[model samples]
Target chain A: MLNYLWGAMIFIGILVAAFTGNMAEVTNGAVNSAKEAVTVCITMLGVMSMWTGIMKIGEEAGIIRSMSKGLRPLLKWLFPSVPEDHRAMDHIATNVIANFLGLGWAATPAGLMAMEELQSLNKHKERASNAMCMFMIFNMSSLQLVSINIIAYRTQYGSANPSEIIGPGIITTLVSTAAAIAFAKAAEAAS
Target chain B: MRAISVLSDLILPLVIVYILSCGYSKKINVYEVFIEGAKEGFKIVMDILPTLIGLMMAVGILRSGGTLELISRAVSPIVRRIGFPPEAVPISLMRLVSSSASTGILLDIFKNYGPDSFIGRFVSVMMSCTETVFYTMSVYFMSVKVTKTRYTLAGALAANVAGIAASLTLCQYLWG
Candidate 1:
């Protein structure tokens, strides 16, 4: 799937660029984006360090453990394959909390850490486990409690009520999350 | 608006303070432990860096080639048939790949139509609810070296469709 998507993007992109007479711009786009990728990594490095550091403190203090334990039942239901006390649960819980609060910077590192933990539990190391797919799907569904970035953008654009969409946003996100859970669970069952 | 924003600002500071103090009281070498955990950041970054570069470059090429505009033009009419505003088709599509690219389209909408308009509010709600499905999948999977992702993308697309459908219904019920 990724192989096809990647190929289509590059192949169709170049063809369209030629047809549109924007070949040079497309070349620059690819090169500049590669550079921008490194820039994004640098930013990720800073945020990941700070967030992981704080999360480590929470872990050692047993705050993280207790919080994840509190969420054990829900986590267990969402991730049936994972053992109850696995370390991935800790990172997954933190990721969910951070995302719910719209703390995307904190969520990414925890989410990636969760992925690494889930990978350790993967039977076929190259193939994603059901748990990993389920986890990633949940992340994609992205049940954020707040849409701060959208709110800020609305404010910037001089909307009369910048946060008016928050209610609708939450509602729509919940619907998506429900759909995601159904789809993931059904897929798990099918396979 | 004010209530939610205020709650959000307070939560972060409180969490940070609580975690640090708890670690301190627990007799943990808080600073050293933080340093140790922070070292994991470099490894994580290195693991996913190649995937990030490839994904971004593809998105960049796709965007620069005007493929999004073309697709949006083609998709707009069909989306309009479903009572979804045609103007939102671009941001909705771009949000699947590059968030920043979608933001550019979003700002264009806000500028042209005003954010208070029905289309503005509709797109806002949709953008708020949706995720960059491909980007999220790529970085997460790449970090773990997972080649065969199976149904994750399919599940995400299902969620995206559901999100858009819900956004349309909610916007209409509330403000349409």
Candidate 2:
């Protein structure tokens, strides 16, 4: 799926640029954007390391376990395919907590771990399970308690009230999370 | 709202204190554990670097080639009816595809219209509220080596659209 999307994007970009005589801009964009990607990751490295370290402390101290215990009921409801004692639940909880804090870079490792654990439980090796789909939906639409990245951008841009959008951000994400859960449930039912 | 804001502000400090105290009570080597996790974090960054570069380059090419503008113009009428500014069409379109690219678009919007401006605030909310659906799905699925992602993309994209709608609507009610 992503393979097709990537191919189409590059193909259409070059074709359109050629027709519009914007090939120079395309060339520049490719180089600059690739550099931008590295720069973005470098910026993310600090935050990711900090949060993941703290989360590691949390994990070693059993905070993550307690947190996962707190979320057990709801998570169980969300992912029926995953068992109660499964390691995937812990990973899922960690991912959800990281996402809620708006630590997306920190969340990816846990999210990947969750997917890998869930995959281990799958009978069909090639196909994604319902639990996997639900987990993806929740991770993708995870409600953020603090949008640190956007706030950082706002402050950098010199906004007088950098946090003003926090209210709308929370509300909008809550709505989207509800929608994601509902869509996942519907999709699961259909499948 | 004020209480929530305060709590949000305190979350970092609270988490840090809680973790430190918990580690202390457990007599765990917090520093060593933290360094280990940090190393893993760097490894995670290295793992995703290629995907990030590919996604960014693709999105950048599309944007620079004027494909996004063309698509934005085509979608303007419907977007206008939903009360979103035409300028935000690109951000919304790119939000699901690549987060860094969307941030770049957001910075452009902020520069053009001050961050305090309605469009700027709207785009900020939109960007904060939504996830990079395709990028996330690809990375996650790739990690698990799941070639047949059944309904994950559809579900995520649906959620993204919902987020975009809610962002536009809430921004209008709160800040418009």
- For candidate 2, the iRMS in Å is 4.7
* lDDT of prediction 1: 0.79
Best by DockQ: 2
Q: What class would a CAPRI assessor give candidate 1's docking? A: acceptable
Total clashes in model 1, counting residue pairs 3 or more apart in sequence or in different chains: 0
Give the alpha carbon lDDT tens digit for every residue of B1-176 in model 2: 56545654565677689888999899999999999988877786677678778877887788788776777788889878857688788777777876655666675566558899988888888887788888788888988788999888888888988988888877777667
**Which candidate tops TM-score?**
2
DockQ of each: 0.44, 0.51
Model 2 clash count equals 0
Clash count list over all predictions: 0, 0
Tens digit per residue, CA lDDT, model 1, A14-99: 89988988888898888877786676566557656666677678767777446656777889999988898889988999888777
DockQ of 2: 0.51
